[model samples]
Target: MAEERQRIRVEFAYDGGPYHGWAKQPGLPTVQAALEDALAMIIRQPIATVVAGRTDAGVHANQQVVHADIPADIWATVPRNAPLAPAPAMLRRLNGVLAKDHPGIIVHQIQEVPRVFDARFSAVRREYSYQIADGLARWNPLYRHIRWQHREELNVEHMNIGAQDLLGLHDFLSFCRPRPHSTTIRTLEELSFSRLPDGAIKARIIADAFCHNMVRALIAACVQVGAGQRPPAWLGERLAAAERTSETKLAPAHGLVLEKVSYPSCEQWAARAEQTRARRDS
Candidate 1:
């Protein structure tokens, strides 16, 4: 009989500046490829991972999640002579490998999880933050990789007002790049803007799921209103249109970061995944 496999969940963070994206592609360095390569070295076999969110190139992640299945015997060999548990040993070894060749990625946690715990489908929500350094904010060259430097001064109040119109269930076609067989309908739980102490503007976006380019597109729309180029009401009109237009623009990918991915309790994992799958199928 084939050896039983154990499902493992890993929480990690990465600077996406050097990689193409999360998904592995031939002739391209990617977060997934780098991580899987590290895993394969330790396990002596190939491994694949399913991520919570497939962030685009130049988009960073403060905390990202993924799940992979490993053969039981291979997992048992992780801590050959060490006193550490398999999970902790695996984390240390993985980080050690990554540090040598892929220093931009770091593994925060690794644990054996229930078979039903899916990093992607079982997720309850994903939260993202976008940083903007407008004309009023002092330009910091050190943060160039993470902040969008805009020439125009932004009005935080106007951005907040425009963001309010995007809350709740809506077809965000105008704010999303269309993908084959994927729906643009998303329930935006929260969208807010605030000025940081450094005079830069920060946007916090929470949603059940976001389509291709959704977060950046939404930010671009709010930036327009905040810069006095459009009225706050224009956001609502864009949602109502349910179609992409020339006016739709995308904020720089470097300014965005995947902050977190929330999931239900252990007992609800399977149920949540089932529900999410059904909704997507419809």
Candidate 2:
């Protein structure tokens, strides 16, 4: 038998404010719907997509990768009647359709990857950046889609110290939105804060995987600590409790952006990735 044709991987970026979320819905606009529609037009088939992260509505993605399995024989049929090649041109074409079909969404890039590569499971680390514009005049019109405007003075030093507590493996129940029968264990590789010259603060978080609303809530908790509303050790205590509580507020999704996703370097972790997928499906 011939070797199975691998799934074609596609990376795209989008402003998630208009769509309900990443998943497809009955009557609501979604990123999945927009992409699937564009894929159907491009490949002339019923295409299904698996995303790296299912970002909440109003969240943004600087880099979101997805995979779709298309037939090897179908490559010849792709509309090559454009200036750019099939993959790149498809992005342009998809953007055009998005401009007409799904407003306020764009496909940045598309590429092919190995068959075993899974967009979600293959990811080893996912990075998210949240921007806060503090004491700002005219905020970045370009960054408005992916930033939160907080005029209040923030103690960046305090926030940095609090963020350091979040590093390493922990049961992040406090930061995560509770899910019935779901494990909240995650390994946070990095959590750091940076102060920009324009008086904006940027919070960057890297994790193997994130539970629902974890990053936003983490930022909220850190912000509270920075503002003196909560003590710096409060997050550490909350993590120790492993109790799911709403005491921590979830920051607005507009400020969050999916920055990048790093995949596993070895095959040993494939089993864990597979298990993660199975758990998500279940």
Tell me model 1's lDDT, rounded to 2 decimals. Answer: 0.94
- Candidate 2 segments exceeding 4 Å error: 1-6, 79-89, 135-145, 265-272, 275-282
The candidate that wins on lDDT is: 1
Candidate 1: residue pairs that collide: none
Which pairs of residues collide in model 2? none
Each candidate: how many clashes? 0, 0
Encode model 2's per-residue lDDT on 159-273: one tens digit a residue.
8887777789888988888678777888998877788777678888999899998999998888888778778888788778887676878888999999897776546346657
Point out the worst 10-residue segment of candidate 2 by lDDT.
75-84
Cα lDDT tens digits, model 1, 114-197, are 899999999999999999999944678888899999989988898898788899999999999988988888999999999889
C-alpha lDDT score of every prediction, in listed order:
0.94, 0.80
lDDT of 2: 0.80
TM-score of each: 0.98, 0.87
RMSD of each: 1.0, 3.1
